[model samples]
Target: MLWFNPRHPSFFYYNTSTANLKSNYQVNTNGLIGQTTALQSVVSWNKTITKCRQNSQIIKAQKLFDKMPLKDIVSYNTILPGLNQAKNPEKVCQLFLEMERVGLKPNEYTLSMIFSAALNTELKLLVSQIHARTICLALNASVFVGSALMKAYADAGDGVGLGKVFNEIFNKDVSSWNALVSGYMELGRMHEAQKTFDTMPDKDVVSWTTLVNGYIRNKRINKARSIFNKITEKNVISWTVKINRYVQSERFVDALKMFVLMMRSDTMPNKFTYSSVLDACAGCCCLLVGQQVHSSIMKFGIPKDVVLSTSLVNMYAKCGDIDAAFSVFESVQRKNLASWNSMIGGYCRHGLGKRALEEFERMIKMGVKPDEVTFVNVLSACGHGGLVEEGEKHFDSTETKYGINAEVKHYACMVDLCGRAGQLDKAEKLIKEMPFEGDVVIWGALLGGCGHHSNTKLGELAAEAISRLKKDHPALFSTLTKIHGEKGARSTVVTLRKILNEKRFRKQEACSWVESPFHEM
Candidate 1:
């Protein structure tokens, strides 16, 4: 028989490697045997449960927990964390209730787990109960639990709750400050977020980046740039965010300049960085700079990355090099849907409709699902090539065959197709019967087709529709006036001039793309 010490837990050590298998163990104290045995059982169960949890065997861990004959506060705490890690918040709450039922008092760790679990679930009343428990137990003053509560309130968009939690944290750390700033940013309260950031005793990279991202989210690009320049220690994320922002804002030239600066600073670009810069080149139709970027991509030894490959295809295609785009497409071995869409759109843009059609058929045959974008390109190809039958077939199959509801853009393509094929009646009927209202693009397509066919009656009607939205579009009005004048509709021309005079409309200067020669880096 082996004797166990009741007072000191560290005194008990069972070395199964050397101990006799048939030996019995008991507490040395006469009446404390049951208590010591229960303690030992709790420790053993906790060890096994923790091991199972670490190995991602939560189900096994729960089974062992359920089978344990003795459970203490430690047992409840161990299993609560495991359940939270497994993303079973509901089970975490259930286990918490069991802890309460058994009269086990919760520590700060347990309360933190409860708050963290409640933050993600849709159980509003759970948070309220947890908050009440924290108040009752006076655990609300704990920094760890307080921070968790702050984050939960932030996610719930309860400004009052967040403020209450923030004030409850008497000793705030960097994480506490970050949670408040991030919460404000998430809620789109830029002024409040900036204010909190300014009041922070020390600002880390995260603090700076959060404010920058907040400015970007609010569409204050200039302010975001201002804050970005103030960061002395900029990382790749800082550079990438600003670069992508310029691309999104359509400031392609500035975006290219920023990329050049980033390269000079020795800050390496990631796949997203390369993709955004390539998009900037494509937007400006800068073929020379685009090729230079391609060379840079190869030099970096990540030329085959699927996303970068797709961007390259898009860049080359938009710059009027369909062959280069096709070459890149063929080079990618594992092509995603985006890669196929880029290639098809490239062919459509360059007026190689028959080739685009062939690629579309091949895409479908390969069992790669084409999305709404693919069909947009496909319908455009058919429309440009005057393949009205093919266009109609694809248009009709959008909802039935592909599970993609035809959006307004797809309908606009169909209208352009019918209008281009001299089926104006079909186009008009389709527009009127569409589930949604036709935008300016749809009417503009009809007017372009009317101009091509010299149909003054429909042209006047389409121009009138456009005028309702774009009251000051001088070029569209000028085109309509010319069409009406040629068809001897002097009354319509006079009416257009009257509307133009009343609105004080002016014809804007034409903007053209002028790409400069690329200087080798």
Candidate 2:
């Protein structure tokens, strides 16, 4: 039965059945021939299942797995990976149990797949049991298995378990070190992550990038930059990390300068690089820089990625080029929720409240669901246009229609909407009945509304509420003082400044920056 013919050297071509054998295809039929044929069928099934899995035909793979005549360790290994890839970890567990029931032992590959799936499943207890099994099977020394175990424990936030697995790894490679470092970073264990990076026998760009990113997360931007500058071979990602760090810190000028330097270099900018630079341009409202970025985007001929397109819309909008913003919005081949939100926000900012509302309606009709930001933009439009009824309807429908909970910003928009229409009582009532307490921004919104209506009484209440928050909002305080002065309350205005000075609440110094076309940092 285990015999191989000279003409047909493959197991798949080995036929033991007497009915199928011809003069040209000869086979020896022994007592083990039936078992050999069955084994051959199993092998064929395994190949089919593997092919199906590779093609991402998970359902078909499952069907093939279920219909197998006889399953073996190979069969289980073949299907388990596909199951894990499909995010069917529960199914993997069930199959593992089934393999055990049939007296089939899982190999190290099977254990690795389980750990990979378990990371996402958050099945910490199950992973623990699997770890014990790996130990009992004496497979813990495997670098592949050890890496997966480390990652699983890290994802579960089980740092101790991760360390134990790392200690047991016999041959730790760069990947192994990266997994542990990333794990430490994710858990905010910067010291431990840094220690691991320092002790690594070989450090790749990924290792450096991970530590740099960790420092950024911990708000150690200078340390991140210092580490970034030390990398001898800088990749696009390293440049992006620095650019992203600048963008996150609101250092728009620096971000744009980095981008310009990146463009001058041989390393081409990707979508993310363009996105960050566009964000900087938007922040600074630099139309020329934004237009330059727009031209680069065209020259690069990058695909219309949603994020890049949305950033372009935001850039143009913030630059006060509403027409260009709309043009970008319309040019988007597929407008996602972000694209719509940007357009609506652009309209709202330009005080084209009617157009913003129209876009909002069109968004809903086109079956694109509105998010919290969507409501924020639309409600803000309503406030600007004095559409109190529309604002109320949208606010009410936030939870019921869109399944989005009304956040503080949404409530602030509602308050502002009512206040804009001179419905001070309604605005006050809404604030009083809010689910959560108002923040400085919420009160500031109400105060601004009061200023617009010259409602000194409500303005006083709003100002008092803000004062109690003990925030250093100099602009709000200045506005309140101006409102009091207008209402013939000179003493009250003077007293407010005295209270501010007594509390040692000095106004924050405002700083702004612009990128120079001639000089690139």
Candidate 3:
């Protein structure tokens, strides 16, 4: 005979006493009697169901669960987590209701799983119902359940519901407090998030990190840094968040300095940290620092996943190291679309137009579909290499074959191709036939082509279109001045030069940087 404890319904105890041997009866908390053999069979079935779920065989687990002769709260609980893992929220809700209908009272674990599964706004009403049920079962005070409820409301963007759940928690732990703070952060209520952090009775690394991330998300980098500096013990996530924000804000120098500080503090850089650092290196063209970072990644034996590999390819390509970029691209075991795009873009950037086109063809032969970005690079490659026929073929294929509509940028590439090939009329016609209004870039491409081929008439038209878009563009005036000077139109040259002077237009001087031994720049 086996007896189940009321407080811990999942656990069973076998009766050793043989006083009622012939009857073979046992009394459990549920007031049910059964032979010990039947209880053993249930235990075996439960173990099998658990193993199936663990192996990601959720369908098998569900089938086994349905076939079980006896169903209890434990059986439902076991299957609920698998359903949640599979992201079948409807099934989770159905199972929960079924448990209720069968008089199987759910424990804290079941409620927590349900709350975690019902995350989106579509399940907001269901979350409220579960909250009410938790209260009815006197399980609302359970820290685990309360934290899950707080997170559900947080994800659903229900600030009031999240705050109410937080207040109702009997003994709030750091996780519950973090949930509340995270909720406020998600709602973009930074002041409340900060206040909650200020009043946390106890704070963990996650608590501090959450507040910092919230500030970063709200574009409050200075405040996030101030809080980060206050943390006595900083973890990898904290450092990564600060560094990533710097990279995003184009503060590449600051991002590098932070990476140096993170290394000084002996905090290991994860894949995300490395990705941001590589981007910073690419932004400033700091090849030396990028090389050192790459060495450290190898020294630390970091796994080069597809994302990190793509970043490496981009950094190398941007740093004028196309060979190295190609090497990294080759090493990527699973080349995704991003990896292919980075490699192709690198080739186009280096004036290796033929190589870029070849690689694009290779990417296609590998069964990789080209995206809009891929086509942009491809068209640019054709323009740079003076492959006008190839460029037109690709431009036509964008709509006819690939189903990708030609954007303005693609059309600009086509105009540049025709202009480079001394086909001024074709370039002008391409601009006129564009589906949308030609922007400054489209006109700029045609103007560049006209200047190259000394087509003063078309150059004048392009300059006029550019002036309508931007009244005082220095490049537009400068290019027009050159075209008029070449045509011996002194009066027109004087007028363009006078406009340049009146607008106080000065082209930004181009400069380059070389990496120095000094770490602090």
Candidate 4:
């Protein structure tokens, strides 16, 4: 339900059990911390590494890794997962280079990290290289290792590699199957994922949920529900699975039905269930459903959870009841960053951009550091509400004061603002100054303001930029069409429509879940 809950993951009471992501580490650096058993075994050293990476103290973990009496393949393996978690997967490569420099043998885990880090196109090349290296190293690929490999290939959009590595495994475990299935689901490969799942020797909650999640994620609700109904024994995950699907799919009635069914089945819905059901209400844009869910949340009080509270606020806001949203927000005793972000987005969405600004300022005054996402929406508000000077000051502050580099979205907002104010040259100059590739959204934003200001020349340039995007985004195409039509370019509109007709186009739900992607702009 919440597009963005900025609260720390630890503060959120999720339904699932604590998973020790591979290559974890424990943090006992502080004096208040307990014994320092520099994880000797590879078995759980990864957990320790994870702790270090989480604390932004990977350097300490690195030191511990260096001092370990006997560093196994898992030792090197441990570092890569930490880097992978940081989202700086390039660091995984750097670590690999370091490994090569140190003369340590690169194991399957090492290669898997590289594969995991590769996104989209790069995944294809890396997966092949990793698969080949697996054979070259003569490494005995364990189920875990093989699963990781399948996961990498699946993530890369290489179904070929996914099938190849998956087929090679003689004795597959639940995790291996889950990995492959999850990968397929992630890449929207439902057909392949389903086929692989059908053959899984044993099915667990993870297996069933992965399929349901795949269907839900791919917007295949009917198939997901069909499989969900067949799940004989439902756990929290099972309930959450269906509830999550309905919430995401905006099927409020179905989610509520499933929740009731879960209670009847003697499976208690967890925080995720509550959050998702609230989300379904939000999606439905029905105030009554949200009120009902709110009462339910009250009856089964999850007092300390920041996420659920945030979800409630979002549900109320989305259901066209900002009064209720603020009422619940005010009731929250332990408000966190997500709480603020949700309320801000809700305000912004409801044409209360000024109020959103006030909330963001409240967050800053409360000493909560705003992430990039916070600035995006605030910048958007600046443009929409005509707070040009305020917008520029905040934009400049991101780099000059906070030391956070200005991303292109911020640049887009500034450009849009200036263009709306008839400062076309300033918008173009800002576009040129942007470090990242400007998206169609940015160019289109400028073009929109240009059109509003009747600046046809800049509009043409914005159209050109929109045309240059490597991949076609439907909304961008639509915006260009509108601009062209307004500027009397009916021929271009016809051409755009023809180009669009060649492809089966589905307008992805206009709802960009992301606050500015769950609470940013």
Candidate 5:
């Protein structure tokens, strides 16, 4: 792999097959004067700019940048990317304004930098302003600039707006179309997204990747596979994207098949692909596949990445291989809070509450701060173990010890603990006193606790809360029906049934691509 060494005096070096670029450089500079004026030398100034950036001499670089007399697009491009590296987009904007105040103009790279820094909501407006500004400035409308604009609008989630931009371009290329399609995919507008994919006159790697990702994002896995099968060429990116989709759709067998095919074809897997494949096996509870993937990752001598390692741990735990999960966890050189939390969440989720709580405490004692997610797993431990007093102490410490405020899940845990312990009155009071209306989970937890305690009054309150929740789940509907029947409230049951029917039927015809991004932990 060719690596750029900007830190070295030469500023660039790599294991290329040849050192002949130096020969060409010498030949190109043979007849040309190397240096002219003492104060203005392009080669010297360029070198200075490179060093200034390498050393992070922000103020000095800006000064040298200002003193330069003869400059070009290359000059501006150099400083803009480095300015972005320094993470002062606001100052980068100032530099663009400075370039504009003079007769100089922006190119595609400049606009791309602007797009990378823009606020998501304000993007379309700002991009339009930019187009207007460019027209008013009489800068040549370049395809690269137009493509960058299309990307900016797409990234902003304005697919229709991006389409409008796409249609305006006369000689649109694959990148232009890809941007619009990618935009639609990001917004989960699969129907219109499919339309864009069908109408594209020409296709490239980017075009396929965009559509493949869109189909997967929209949960049109079959369509994604159809597109993947039809591809005339494949690259590492295509492999990763397709494998990732299979993983995302919770189809571990398909992911494993693709990985074996890629490996047999002599296509090497990178860190990203390895992580995704392992994640897929873990998600589908394919212990055999999980073990094979783990062996491959090890054979490749890939470092134990925290995300990859955690995925293995959780996968092993999920697939009833707690020993493997613990072994993987202990094997990693470094561990993040997510590493600790995943195993804890897994343990609690699978009824290993005691182990989960022990791991949580151990994490805290090691100077690792427990986040809200950690608390959620610990609460699950409390729920399973019936440690009501300890659950309260941990819940209260969220704000008191960790300075993390109690969220809806935390409140849900408290309601579950209290209601299960036969403190129905306090649970009801806590639900009402919650800073916000609790979600379906909190209500469901309360309902389950009431069923255990046989508190019909609190059950009624939970049913009401469930009815008001945003997302409908099987549990809430069933709980309300059971609660109404248990209390002999025929009217409430009829009302609840009507609401559930309405929700099921009146919601849009679009298939939900959502995979419950919401998590208790």
Candidate 6:
């Protein structure tokens, strides 16, 4: 009779009325059963490790891997990627060495992960060692490995190495081409990037976007737009890049027009797209356009994550709608540091120093740590509200309590704070005591205070410092002229005015935005 083994479903046992059956069965089946069970265990372990990695429990995955009684190449491959994801390049290299010690050879996937890990590290020697290994193993021909090597070399700024890897690819895919183009772009070699992009037989959305982004990075907006226009199939990323570059260039109107065109297309605008659009609205202070975007965001039912919520807060605040900004801030389920900073900045912009300070306190109470930007806004609020004591306390606490070294901008804020409260002597003393040399901003702050207090001597000193730093600064000469005139120095004012005329100095005209029924300007 043949009896099926339920535990090992694929195997069957033959039982007969013979005394030799037991020994025969054991001899034939023990090795096979043991191998089958071991294989099953490895597979099960791999699944658990993969689950741990997917859940971002990399430490748990490493622990499981350490406890494994048996490990194969697949086990190393599985855990190596998790370590790479965790940005532990040292651990990845260590495990790779361990694999070598255990007599396991790495496959293409292993080399790819190692190359990825190498990209994050600045160890040129480690990269060379890995490259030599790939050549020895003849795995350099692998498209996967080749692309990764190109990226690693690109990041190292080794154009020669990148070129060598690209030439060695056995079957060049679009990814390989894209990698080369991206490498050139990263190195700021736009000509080479364009040449490689043009030579590609097949182009995906990523390829197009990469080239466009490369042009934008190199500050070739016209070239970027030309490439963007040629893309037959434009994805959200493609459109977003164009719009974002427009915003960055301060071409807010162009960004809005692009957004309008993007909406007319089938591709839906994502959170990033909306963020850029909001920035454009803020730039021009177009409240109507901002409200329309807010309506669209609600209509699309997009989840207001921290980034999007923060963007909305900034837009509303900049467009002179503080109430709406605060409402958006309140609605955020999970507020981040940026969210708090934006709210505080909004209050400062509107001269609500007390409110801004209150918000800062609320942020600290909620355990959100303040960064350099946070303190800048807070100090500016103190300057606006004439809270000199409060500003000095926060400024001092920045380094002592928060461990954030006061930067030049922080010093400028302090100068402004003191200068505003008519403490011109204190402001000048602060500048002289600064560890770093005072810049034009610091001098300008002191000069403004001098002009307000009619101190011609200190004003001349501030003007001289400004002239030394920025010779062509029209505002410096203009402000200095005003200081001299206020001090009844008619001859000095006349000389400054003549110099300004000769230099063709003109102050930038300030403009305000107003919505009309027919159009906007």
Identify the leading candidate in terms of TM-score.
6
lDDT, model 1, position 415: 79
Predicted candidate 3 versus true structure: per-residue lDDT over 1-521, tens digit per residue: 34355765545444445453322134553533443556678778889999999977788999999888766667888899999876689899988887776556789999988888887737766778788999999998888988888888878777998999999988888999998898899789998998999999999988988898788777888988898899999888889878887888788998999999999999999999999999999989999999999999999999999999999999999999999999999999878778999999999888899999999999999877787999989988887798988998999999898788888778878887888789999989988888899878778788877877788999889889887877666777877888888889999999988988998988533210001111111
**Reference-based TM-score, model 2:** 0.69
Please identify which of the two predictions, 1 or 6, would achieve the higher lDDT against the true structure. 6
Question: Model 4 over residues 1-521: C-alpha lDDT tens digits?
Answer: 00111342111111122362211133224411311222224436656765786665666777767665444445677676766664566666676766655445676667767767765434356667767767666652567667877777766677777777767777778888898898888888788889989988988988998898889989888888898888877789878877877866667888888877887887767788888888887877878877887777678775637798899998998888998899989988878777888898788787787999999998899877676777877887777687888988999888787667888767777887777677778888888878877776677677666766666677778778776863565654655666777788889889878767776555544432212331122
Q: Model 6: per-residue lDDT, tens digit, 192-248?
A: 999999889998998998898788777888888888899999989989988988888
Give the per-residue lDDT digits (tens) of candidate 5, residues 1-521. Answer: 11222333222222234543233134233222322232135456767887897766666786788787545445676777677765567777777777665445676677777766563534345776776765564432456766676667766666666676666666777777787778778788777777887898998887888898888878888888888878878888899888988887778788888988888878788778888887877777788887887888889887778887887887788788887788889887778787998788888767788999999888888777788889988986887787888998999899988788899878877877776687878777888899886777777777777766656777767767665664565455656566677778899879877877876734332111111222331
TM, every model: 0.66, 0.69, 0.64, 0.67, 0.63, 0.72
Q: Kindly report which residue stretches of model 1 are placed more than 4 angstroms away from their true locations once superposed.
A: 1-188, 490-521
Pairs in steric clash, model 6? none
Pairs in clash, predicted candidate 3: none
Best by lDDT: 6
lDDT at 166 for candidate 6? 91
409-482 per-residue lDDT for model 1 (tens digits): 78878878888888888888888999987777777777766766777878778878877866556656766876
For candidate 3, the C-alpha RMSD (Å) to the true structure equals 10.3
Q: Write the per-residue lDDT of candidate 2 for residues 1-521, one digit (tens) a residue.
A: 22233454343232346565444234446524754776688889899999999976787999999987677678989999899877788898888888766555677898888888787565756777888889987899888888888888887888888889988888888988988887887778988998999999999898898788778777787888788878988889878877887888778998888787776777888888888889999989999999998898899897768899999999999899999999989988878888999999999888899999999999999877788889989998998798999889999999888678898878878887887688888888988999899876667677777876777888878878887874555655666776888888989899878877877776634310001120111
- lDDT value, residue 297 of candidate 6: 97
Weakest lDDT window of 10 consecutive positions for candidate 6: 512-521
lDDT of prediction 5:
0.72
lDDT of 1 at 299: 90
Q: Global lDDT of each model?
A: 0.79, 0.80, 0.83, 0.72, 0.72, 0.84
- What TM value does model 5 have? 0.63
RMSD of 4: 11.4
Instruction: Between candidates 3 and 5, name the one with more favorable TM-score.
Output: 3
